[model samples]
Target chain A: MALFTEAFLTALLAGAISAGIPLLLVGLGEQMSEKSGVLNIGIEGMMLAGAYTGFLIAWKTESMGLGFLAGAGGGMFVALFMAVLCVRLGLNQIVIGISLTLGAEGATAILHYFQFSRTYPRLPATLKWDIPFLHDIPVVGPALFGREPIVYFALFLVSVFAYLYRRTHFGLALQAAGDKPAALDSSGVDVLKVRAVAVLTTGALAGLGGAFMAIVGAGIFVPFMTHGNGFIGIVLAMLARGRPLWVLGGATLFGACLSLTTALQVAGIDIPTDVIQMLPFAAVMVVLIVLGSKANLPVSLGTAYARGER
Target chain B: MTSEMAIAPDSGENERKSRLNMRDDRLHFLIITIGPVLATLVIASFILMAMGVSPLDYYGYIFQRGMLSPSGVQATLTRMGPLLLIAASLIVCFRAGIWNLGGDAQFILGAVFVAAAGPELVAILPVWLMLLLCLSIGAAAGAVWSLVPAFLRAYQGINEIITTMMMTFLGGSLANVLVKLVFLDPETTVPQTRTLAVSDRLPRLFDTTVSSGVLLGLAAVLIVHFTMNRTAFGLRLRIVGANAKAAVHAGLPVATLTVIVFSLSAGLAGLAGAVAVLGQTGNVRADWNPAYTLTIVPLVFLARFNGFATIAFVFLFSVLSIGSESAARRLGVPNYFTLVTMATLLILMAVAEMIDQRRRKRKEV
Candidate 1:
């Protein structure tokens, strides 16, 4: 009859990690894209593509690894459109980004309707890897350490990205590509190439996030399953500026808010569940408004890099 | 909030532009405009073939039921009421270089508000007066929902795409709350807003089944076209769209224009919702989000944000949607194919624009 049992709190924290990992991956990818000056709004579509293909492949092969690969590949496939249209052809980034998402939604829905709508098959439970000594620390350990390998890898990626942005030459080129493509071009780097690679990498990460959502988080793929996670990732990336650690912080905060929503509902809160569900989105909006004005942004963000064009 | 869309691939040059001032040659313009639609049909036919549905049969059925039949024509016209208004809304936003993808949320908010209020007002006021008030309420609700995102984007330099989308998620959830709890009609068997009688709805056109809301939608798009293309205000907005920095340097109120763009576009979208509730749906049901906005996004883009062209595309889309539903029923294929086709058309539209731009540059060379 206790409202906040130890087990309940552990499950809540575990759910936070389950949700945060996808946002973390997506935000990391989106950060790289923004750093390279492409807004990359199509991450939503990429995530959906990954979720569908990831679920389909995992179901067919019964291999989680291959499923994640297919998910990433599917995202890259959608990103190809962004690369060609927005980057290569110099089109509107926002319009193309939105169109790609719409396209992915329709395509995935059709594929799902034809392939899996009848059986509604779901995967088995996600396997967890218990870290020695760490996972025994009661609720915190089980929630943070005794989880899927991808969760650890996603966390590791935060540090990797931190090092990538602050130390590497490629990171400087990326910064140059976003801040001043002309300077990067004068220095003999192809600005378009840098931006293109960044976008494609974004697709892979977003796709993997989608795959994780399906194979590990939900164990099933429905059309539009990614929901607004991709958009949320964009928010995270924008807020992070160029800091992967900040992205992690923002994403975790969002994930914790999601858990809080579930907890409030479970506690028999009088408000409608629909109203309760608005917390994460409302939280993200408030965060964006409060921190957005002061966040440093890429000068060339959302613009196509056309040589010799001011 | 960002100046990244400067001329949308216009090579960073600030130039005066409008429907009247577009300098494309007729052949180039025709190819760019018509190419994507035909290509989309061809690709969609291939998809149909893969599904074992004969393309000929599908096309034949769509044409017969959606266009050649009386009842279908009436239905298509009724569908156009909301779509045409949305097209107008999109034209306004795109013209100002602001993206308002929150149409779905705005539309839902507008429709739910009107549905919740209409019955009470119709009891006290004349039908015509009630309808006007309901539509106004819908528009005001939509504009109000848009204010936060508009303010954030205009004053704070945050992207509206993120803010608008976040608001959309909120709007959907909030509308469900309003409909399921606050607006539930106790007299109804199901949890839904109270419905008005058919006679209380927008009157049909001259004994036909088509609602008079179609005229409102059509007139709105036309007015947008004339105003955006012909008026000094339209020119100022276009100047902001083409180059916000230039507009600012020219002493235009850039932030105000951006907010006005949001209010006008979202207001029209809300009006579309009002028209639908007033003319077609009659009531807001629990968990009903028709998602007509995303479909209209591609349509406006394929129309290149032009008003007259948008009118033509809306009619075609209405027919396609009506026909596709029946075709999907008969062919045992899912009806989502219409969305796939629209999405393909959108991609092709971008490709076509790219080709047109390349050809223009080559000609100049």
Candidate 2:
């Protein structure tokens, strides 16, 4: 009858990891785009599209791999419009981003209604790989070291992104594209091309994250199931301010907060469910405000680049 | 003497070419305005086909039910009340180059406040006075909700888009909490605020089913349009929006204007919430959001800040929304198809605008 049992605590830790992986993937993707000076507000749409497509593919083929690939493809499909309208055509980024999200939501919802409304199929349990020595440890070992392959891949991406941002010419070009596109252009780099690649890569990563949410986290996809994870990812990326490690930390913190809320509700805490739910959102915002107050964004973050129109 | 003769003939030819370009420009303007709408419809038709529904049948139902039928026309007109008001709110903020994506939050807060306070106030005051107070309270709450992002953008240089959206999420959660926990009508099994009686509600317009809120929305639009176009205060706000540095050099109070613009824009959204409750919904319920804010964004954009054009676009949207509900049921498609169409329209409009800009630049060259 004890509320703070070891089992309960272990479950909470596992839940946090489950919840955090999507945010981490989305944050990393968003960071890449922001680094190239594109604020992709349409990521929510991409995530939703990815979720539906990923879920559909996984359900149809019983292959998680193909599902994830389709999810990324779906996300990239929406991102293509973002690239064309906002990046190539020199339109308003925010407006186009919003339109894409709305469009994606509608498209995915309609697709779900037609294909799966009558019978909402849930996926089988996901396949997880256990690390040799780490899995033998106590509660911490199982919760951290034993996860689906995507979770490990998502975590590994932090280091990969860190390396890309720190020690490469492509990384330098991305930095210059965000900070001073004209200078980058004059230096013989194609600013638009760099931004296009970053935005597309962001779509693929975000789509994968959404697929993870549907295929592994929830084991089922529902309309608007990505919820506000995409927006939360934007916040994480913005607060992290070019630091992939910071994104990892923020995502973990946010995920932990989400678990805490669920734990509170399950324990029959004498508080309104709505207020309890608000905890994660409020906690993330407060932490970001305090820690990221000094974080500086790219100089020309949301502006469209024009070659000679200074 | 030979150079002068050559120049005179060339000048005559250039004049004819310039006149031809002028005529082409007018035709281009017409195409640019209508092209996006047509593109959106065509794209939406493909989506319909994929769903195994005939696009013609769906469009027919929407037009017939939304505009042609008497009852459908009434419903569409009634629906326009909130849509028009929210469009007005968006116009105000977008004109000032501020993106108040928190309109949804402000709107929900306004509705919550009005629903919580209206029933009690009716006991102590006359009906008209009580309604007025409820609206003012709603507007005040919405304005206060927006102040956080406005203050942050004005002083701390934080991006309003992210902050406002976060606030919207917070607002939605808070509204549900208020309904389910704080203001729950004890007699009802459902989680909702105390509903006002019919007598306490806003009277129907001209003995018709349409709410008088539509009239209020129209009045707000006209006043806002005139203020934005005719007044010096409006000019100052526009200058601040057009170029903040130039406004600063002109000695304008940029920060103060930012605050005021946010307040007025949020106040309009708040009023929309109040009107929706008093005129139609009657109370606030848990987990309810009409999502009027985002739906109206594209319409306001297409209208290009013209009040009359906004009214026209709002009418078009209302017809689609009201008409599509039955069509969705009949065609076995989700009602969300309208959102897809609106989003497509917005994207196409942006593309069209870009093309127009390119053409203008070429002409300048």
Candidate 3:
């Protein structure tokens, strides 16, 4: 009956990974959007779209791989709206984003009510690939090394993004798209196209992250299952100061805090569970307050881009 | 007229131009406002047809039940009591160019505080005094909840969006905690605040089922519209919202105005919470969050932040919401479909707004 056993600790660490992966994927996608100055407030809606489509397809097809793909596709479909309205039409990013999220929420809820609300089909546990020596080392080993193959891909994306931001010409265009669209345009580049691509990429990434939540994390889809993970992704991206690894770190820390909350409640702490549940959100706020000032954000983050207008 | 023109050479021209502009604005407002609504209906009808539900039946049901029937009209008006207050709060903030997304959280906290305090106060105090105290508590709780995010935004240059949303999550959890732990009514097995008797709650208007909260909502929106349009303080806030840098250059208290906007909007939201509880539910339960904020965001936007237009929109929204529920029951369509309808309307509204903006820009050019 004692707490903090090897099994207990392992489960806790595993829970952290399960919770953190969606944030990682979402944060990385939001990073891409922010980098191109789109803000992409529809991250939550995109995630919901991904989750719904990902779960529906996976359940019907009985393939987690296909589910993740559908999730990405679903996210991109919603993101296309962002690309069209906010990027192409020069609409208010924040307004469209909130509306998109609400739309997605409503759309997904109705879909669920029709298809899954009555039936409530759940997928089997997600298959994980165990790394030979590393996965056997202990709690950290099993938690980190024995994750689904996508976890490794998600972790590796940080490095890839870092290199992309630092090395590529496209990266410069993306940066310029966000920071100085007029200058980027002057250089004979299509700023809108770059932004659209960035937003689409963001949608795909967010969708995939959402699919991971349903397929790997919960093995089921429910309305509002993303549960503000998309917003946290935005926060992580913002607080990371345009650094990919920092998003990983922030997501991890938030995940760790979430796990601690779960662990405390499970341990029968002599306190209200709701108070414990508030920790992660409160922690994020504290982090944002302390570091938000120092986080150098995009210059044209929320503003719509246009020709010959300030 | 000649003397007036002689005194100020362009006065006649300016007056004529303004009169013409006012007419143009009215036309533009009608096109912009009603255009998206019709578009949403058309688009949603196609989706409904695809889903095997009769679009005619759906719209017919909404029209008959929500608009035509007296009881349905009462329910819609009852629903509007809180909705209008929230809309007022949103219009205020959006006008000041701030997003007050934390309305749901502020609302819940306010309602919870009032629900906890209302029953206790009614025992000792007169009905009028108790109701007044409860309303004040609700407003105070909501304002207090927003203070932190407002300070963060005004002082530290933090985005109120993140801070306010974060506060919402925390506030929701805190509300549940307060209900379950502190205010648990011992008389009932359910975890809820002690409910006041219906007689002790907000008085019924004209001996009808509708609560007096509707009057409060109407008053609030009108007061806000007048204050924001016809007053210097509102103009200052609008200036700060329009361009903070310009306001600062002009020696306006931009930071303080920002804080005021947050509080005023949040206070209205809290007042909404109080109205809903006092006028209808009479108490809060654990995990009781209606999340009217996000839904109302589109409604306020559809109204173009104009109070009069928002009143009409809120009424339409309540009708849509109330009618959709019964229609869903009759047609076997999920109730969530109304949200789909709303989302479509919101998008179309954005498109219309975009087009309108383009037309304005071209006109300016």
The digit string of per-residue lDDT tens for model 1 on B1-365 reads 35555344333342343233456555666787688878888998999898888988888888999999999999999999999998999889888889788999999999999999899999999999999899999999899999999998889877777788888889999999999989999998777999978888888999899999999999999999989878999988888888788999999999998999999999999999898999998999988998888778767876777787899889988999999998878887778787777678777887888877777679657
TM-score of 3: 0.94
How do the residues B211-307 of candidate 2 rate in per-residue lDDT, one tens digit apiece?
Answer: 8888888988888888887799877777777767777899998889889999999999999999888888889989988878876776676567779
Between the candidate structures 2 and 3, which one is better when assessed by DockQ?
3
- lDDT string for model 3 (A1-310, tens) is 5887776677778888888999999999999999998887789999999999999999999988998999999999999999999999987676688888988988998888866666678898888899999988988899899989989999999999999999999999999998889999989999999999999999999999999988998888888899888988987887787889998988888787677766655655566668867887898787766765734667778777888775
Determine which window of 10 residues in candidate 1 chain A has minimal summed lDDT: A262-271
Q: Native-contact fraction for each model?
A: 0.58, 0.52, 0.61
Model 3 per-residue lDDT at A15: 80
- Model 1 spans > 4 angstroms off: A264-271, A288-295, B6-24
For residue A45, what is the lDDT in candidate 1?
93
**Chain A TM-scores of all predicted models:** 0.94, 0.95, 0.95
| Residue A295 displacement (Å), model 3 | 4.6
lDDT tens digits, residue span A178-244, model 1? 9999999999999888889998999999999999999999999888889789988987887777899
Ranking by DockQ: 1, 3, 2
Q: Which portions of model 3 miss their true places by more than 4 Å?
A: A265-272, A289-295, B1-18, B363-365
Better of 2 and 3 by TM-score: 3
